[model samples]
Target chain A: MAVAESPPSDPEAPPKVRVGRTPGRLGNRVFQGISTASGIFILIILAAVAIFLLVRAWPALIAAPSAFEDVGFMLGRDLWSWVWPLLFGTAISSVIALVVAVPLSIGIGLFISHYAPRRLAQGLGYLIDLLAAIPSVIFGLWGIQWLQPLVSPLFTWLSTNGATAWLEENVGPTIFTGYQAPARNILTAGLVLAIMILPIITATVREVFLQTPRLHEEASLALGATRWEMIRQAVLPFGRSGVISATMLGLGRALGETMAVLMVLSPGYLINFYLLQPGQHQSIAANIASHFPEASGLGVDALIASGLILFIMTFGVNLIARWIISRRAEFSGAN
Target chain B: MSKRIDVNDLNVYYGDFLAVEGIDMVIEARSVTALIGPSGCGKSTFLRTLNRMHEVIPKAYVTGKAVMDGQDLYGPGVDPVEVRRQVGMVFQRPNPFPTMSIADNVLAGVRLNNRRISKSDAADLVERSLTGANLWNEVKDRLNLPGSSLSGGQQQRLCIARAIAVEPQVLLMDEPCSALDPISTLAIEELISELKNDYTIVIVTHNMQQAARVSDRTGFFNIAGTGKPGHLIEMDDTTTMFSTPSEKSTEDYISGRFG
Candidate 1:
């Protein structure tokens, strides 16, 4: 049994002092701390952005002077009027991206981890890591040039024959819908986002799959199990939480992705359930990124205010993902 | 009744390192055979070679024939999967699947192989397998809990239950009771003796008395050098191996003269 030796920190615990500062045991950690200043500075900058956003958006946060019909107290425009559409689009598109990305990413991770030869697996892992490290702006530029035509043929085929009766009724009335699709739409944006985030999820999942105990696998194989069977029983169930955490990490990125969505999705102000509709349904990040450069009057406050909402949303998502990652070993438990 | 193993000039290797060399022994069906040696003498490696469990590592290979009844086990037509199905193994360390419940751990081999048995039949298999490993009464009420939740000894028994669930002809146990407490160790020893009544049991252990007490026959393997591998020194009836005759190295090992 693994007893919790300290329920919390034990009150009777002896006082301790830093080992590096001790007379005889001084080491390289102290020397390294001096050169790591830039690393420390980056954390401070992240903190500064959060604090600045908090302080600047406080007026809308406290309450609008007009006491606007803002449900979220987002500056000039009422919250429901402006924030909801962007928030909805951000959530819907990211979720759709997650739904598309997760299974395929896991499949890719599984293929590379279990199915590939050693050198090939290593090469694939490096490739995926390189893809993940590529700057977001590059993917956004690529998406604009690449994603539109990629999805056009499939969209055209589906609207033409796949949904014929529904298409016949709605095609003429909504010409820019799937029937006369302009191609740069929510799904196109989502597919692009899915591609961008695939590497991140796959890396996280692949590492987890790799960490599965060799002994458990050997035990399975010795019991007359085939390779696939060994993985299904021993590797998959053990790595399920790891895969969930990885997918959620990618979802957090997808939620806040700005340049790609803004470029690929021609931003407008209509909210429609039809995913293929060629219209403007902006994301929170894209809204802030596009509007912040030239802002005046209440629009500045509104933009900053919306940015605060987004910052909070992303923070909440990240917090949950961390919680999930931390609890993963517990869910799998110790073998 | 299905088979007996005759290992002749057997050698075990992990990459370029030959871990065990020139082992010659016969393990009788429906009886207990113990391989005992000091740490790093390659006793466990030889045990692993009996069912080809050591082949899991990339670059790990072996030479010479391990004949089971009529067929050479390492021959071209023989399948490692089928060999493993017939000759199951328990590791030096207990390894029950952490994500599965105790009942599910017992059913893992059958379930993963897509062997369909009714849920009631699965329940019966769980009980019988656990009973076979001498773990059922202790774990019966908590069969639904995760296998990792069990105490170390119970977890080891769960692994043993998992090994026997498919009902193999031979059981290869590599220090199966090494990590257990005396009570658990006693339980496993009892379980081994009972299992030998029906299955050909080959166990490897550094515990000298364990080999003397449980085995019908004992084989001694001794290592020579840093680069060179261990060789099987002698095999005889357990009574003679412990009491009077054998190789000087075997006598030195058992009498605590030298490793």
Candidate 2:
């Protein structure tokens, strides 16, 4: 009825309802469409990359001589070799990096956020962040030229007196049969990775720690708690999930790191537990980097297959980190 | 375990800035002393000094002495942590540890000190403290629930329970009922009266009616001008202070003439 009445009004009068000519309305819709398109575009690009990797990797697996001995298996070598050693090396080195980085990051984060005076904290925080800006190749070069020489004595001592002694005493000499202590090894590679990732974890965790409410800290102090006790009771509990996600972020970087591991570690095919020794393990990214230029025919497909695996591993680490963060959301009260 | 507090010529400062100056008062044992003042008059600052909580702020310092029982709280060898343990505090806003449960919140003061309690003893202490705060029946069945799940007034009472669980000689409250509704404010006022029988209570409040209703003695604090340090204007019995305050500023402040 209203529409019929409006049509009967004077023809010279402006229309009762405004059309799509309003700049504010048109601009808002256009901006919204752009944002939605950008989000969808990102998803499409990610999917395309995944599908491309999977399609390229399929030929290497299907061309294998046997089903059980193909690229499907993680432990064999006959043209389409298994990825067990690369996977093992990646896992162990990244795990070692996480073990070394997490505690040290938390300690540094706490010192910067809570313990240090304001000016010192600012200066220390800036210095730590500068570490993240250093190029990966530079870290690799430093690890090889300087870090290796410095750690050689410590590595020699460990091989003679540390876990090496216990392993030889209990498990026998079979394990160390082919082990050779080279200057570059998985341990050195992992140590370099740890230093590379420390800044990321420390920066993230320190921001989280700083976000802890002042009231909670004051409440803990007013309860007769010591400074350390107050931190444990309030700051640590509040930042627990943040710490987990920060460590996972560092782990993700360590897992896919190519150049630094390549420069520091002497690559080999077999997985060896003698981390202090050299010529033992080869991470997937480092292997792919070193082999990609010379690779031909199915060899390229094999490198892509290894790349696919590394991608999945890093993706899984990030997914788990997100899950842990969401699970802790209810208790964190950060909302 | 109540104790009298003797504050002599107290001066509080944050670095070069004096926050409050020349506060001398005798806070009797087993009674409530209400500090009533306008905002920025440093009533809360003076209350925090009683527990050494003011110095928690960076560069904050206090001079003079607060003698509790026979011990000087500001003595060179005295530990602030020990002073805090002896004199507990409830803040303007209820700040229950969001990560802790109701039971754990009550036990925080004891547990944070690294003093272990038997399971049965912990349960008993929780029940006793909750009962003292008048929050036992409402929360007893849901002791495992997070403390943040409670209403604003309930959270404040839970904080009170946590403070009293340590069995402090004195309890300092900085406008404990300011964030509550009228009914909750009345409930806390009643609780304060009951609490004074066991603990020497010092409360800072902007509410004159609350001061009149709950306190045995009332101290009025006022600032001279902007950027000037706050000072205590007068101290007297609650009845005298409300009806016939010695200072004109106290009379003006109490009667809503001016801050």
Question: Tens digits of per-residue lDDT for model 1 on A73-157?
Answer: 2334564467778888898789879999999988898899898999999999999999999988898888777767777888787
Candidate 1, residues B1-259, lDDT tens digits: the string is 3368988888888888889888888889999999987788888878888888877878889999899977888999788888898898998788988888889899988886577889999999999999998899999998988888888888888998998888888999999988888988888899888888889999998889999989999988888866779988888999999997458888999999977
Candidate with maximal DockQ: 2
**Alpha carbon lDDT at B70, candidate 1:** 77
What tens digits encode model 2's per-residue C-alpha lDDT throughout B44-158?
Answer: 9999999999878999999998899889999989999999999999999999998888999999999966798999999999999999999999999999888898999999999
Segments in model 1 whose C-alpha atoms lie over 4 Å from true places: A1-77, A163-182, A318-331, B69-71
Superposed by TM-score, candidate 1 places the C-alpha of residue B194 at a distance from the truth, in angstroms, of: 1.5
Q: Could you give the CAPRI-style class of model 1?
A: medium
- Candidates' C-alpha lDDT: 0.83, 0.90
Q: Highest TM-score: give the candidate number.
A: 2
Q: For model 2, how does the per-residue alpha-carbon lDDT over A1-335 read when each residue is reduced to its tens digit?
A: 44555445678878769876775887899999999999999999999989999999888757654533433223347433457789889998998899999999999999999999999999999999999999999999999999998888777776676466777878864333333445688888999999999999999999999999999999999999999999999999999888998998899899989999999998877776768667778899998998888777677888888898888888988898889888756567563
When candidate 1 is compared with the true two-chain complex, its DockQ is: 0.62
Report the lDDT of model 2 for residue A53: 92
Off by over 4 Å in 2: A1-31, A65-81, A162-167, A171-181
